[model samples]
Target: MKTFNYHSAKDVKEASKLASSSSAFLAGGMTTIPSMKLGLATYKNIIDIKGIKKLSGIKVSGKAVTIGATTKHAEVANSKEIKKAIPSLAALAEGIGDPQVRNRGTIGGSIANNDPAADYPSACIALNAVIHTNSRKIDAEKFFKGMFETVLKSGEIIEAIEFQVPQKSNYQKFPNPASRYAIVGVYVAKHKNGINVAVTGAKSCVYNDKDLAKTLSSNFSAASINNVRVSSSGMNSDIHASAEYRANMVKVFAKKAVEAC
Candidate 1:
């Protein structure tokens, strides 16, 4: 790992100021640290946000659940309020990276990383989540741009994520054998807003399938996915699975999500 200067920000203001420079914000460091360690990334400064007390915890209301940016996956998985309001969401959190990662990784880190195969983005997109940034709130649809990319600007920081509790929601994934990252993961959600089908791992970024959404909106059942065709356009092709194979996995997992729900 390359040596870099580390700075711990006392508050959001300091963090934002530090972020304006060519530095990386240290959340749980689950993604950044590994990349830095592998020489895949280099940064002159590391602004640790661990000192910011406000960016942690879970808040639940009658309408939605708001998770603080620094909230760990373990916290989400064990949150009673989240479990009651959105069990499927809690289940998804529990299924993220394993125990150590769950304990150490922050929601902000996961979202900022925006990994193509990450589980959180799938839920965020499907559940109609609103990403609260230091400057403004962004709809999930507008948050992600591409692989490891987001709409976040320089000096911007993710504050929290608010999810509209779905009437019915579930997630299913086909994981890689060694890394446990998803080969193809699907998140399906149904609510008054209608149905949302967000897919990750099969593409360069988490994406919503309007066609599948229409099908599931018409009928919220596993049978609904049987007739819907998944496309390979812009889908990923790799050693784990081909574009065609991954396309098929979406349908299979969509059915499984229904069953799991």
Candidate 2:
């Protein structure tokens, strides 16, 4: 890693103030540290936001569950409140990388990095999550831009994410054996308003499958989408899986998610 100035920020104000084009705010450093080591990313200053007490916790209400920015994956997986309110979310957290990664990774860092195959973004879309930042709030749909991209601005820090509670929900993924990142993941959420089908890992970005959602909203069953043909256009293809294969897995996992729900 290159030399950089490390600053321990005590609060959001300090963290945001330290932010600049050449600086980064470190929460869990799950992605940041690795990128720096690989020379994929470099920063002049590293602002440690984990010391900011207000940025770590879980809050549950009847209508929504609010998770602080620095809340670790393990914390989310183990929270009784999270399991009770959103079992799918807890399952998602528990399925992340591994014990070390889960214990160290934060929800904020994962979402902010916006890795296409990352699990949290799919949950955010399916659960109708709102990302609360120091400046303003952004809907989940507007928050993710593309692979490794997001709408977060310079000097802005995410404070928390609030997910609307659903009547029923489930997540299913075909994980990469070595990394555990999803090759194809689907999250199905049934709400009073309607149903949401969010898909990830198969494309350049996580997105809601409107066609599947519409179909499921009408029938709410795995068989309803059995004949639904998912197009392979714009899907990622590599050594692990082909675009067509990934497209098929989307449907397969969507059905699994619905069945699991």
Candidate 3:
């Protein structure tokens, strides 16, 4: 890895100021550190935001949950509040990578990376979560652009995320054994207005299916999607899985998610 200057920002404002096109904001450093080590990513400077206390905690109100950007996955998985309020989300966190990765991975870091195979994006979409950044709040639909991409501007750091609680929600993923990254993941949420379904790892970015959502909103059954077909047009076709396979997994996981819900 190339040597780089590191700055320990005292707060979000300081971290934002320290960040630039050539600099990266370090939260848990789960993805960034590995990318740096592999020489896949390089930076002239590293702005450490892990020290900012404002970016580490969970807050739950009547129908909303706000999670600080730097809050670790382990915290989410073990939090009694999360387990009670949104057990499926806790389960999702628990299933991410393993103990060590969960201990070190932060939600903000994961969302910011926007990896195609990452799990959080599906939850974000299904829950209609709002991504809070240093500048403004962005809806999940607008946050993710493509693989490893987001709408965040240079120097803008994610502050926290706000999720609107649902009546029922569940997440299911078919993980690649080696990396534990989702080969196909599905998140289903039944809210007051309607149901929402988000898929990840099957495509270039997390995608919401209105048809599935509408069908499930009414029936709320695994059999509801039995006749539904996930198109293979936009799915990823790699050695691990084919586009047709991912298309099928989307239906399979969605059914499992509905069953879990």
Candidate 2 total steric clashes: 0
* Lowest lDDT 10-residue stretch of candidate 1: 14-23
User: lDDT scores for all predictions?
Assistant: 0.91, 0.96, 0.93
Please identify model 3 stretches exceeding 4 Å from their true place.
none
Instruction: Give the distance in Å from residue 58's predicted Cα in candidate 3 to where it truly belongs.
Output: 0.4
Q: Which residue segments of model 2 deviate by more than 4 Å?
A: none
Per-residue lDDT of model 2, residues 1-261, tens digit only: 899999999999989998999999998899999999999999999999999999999999999999999999999999999999999999999999999999999999999999999999999999999999999999999999998999999999999999999999999999999999999999999999988999999999999999999999889899999978899999999999999999999999999999999
Error of 2 at 106 (Å): 0.2
Q: Residue 150 in model 2: shift from native, Å?
A: 0.7
- With candidate 3 superimposed using the best TM-score fit, by how many Å does residue 152's alpha carbon deviate from the native? 0.2
State which candidate has the highest lDDT: 2
What is the Cα-based TM-score of model 1? 0.98
lDDT of 2 at 168: 98
- Rank by lDDT, descending? 2, 3, 1
lDDT computed for candidate 1: 0.91
Note the residue pairs that clash in candidate 1.
Answer: none
Pairs clashing within candidate 2: none
Ranked by TM-score, top first: 2, 3, 1
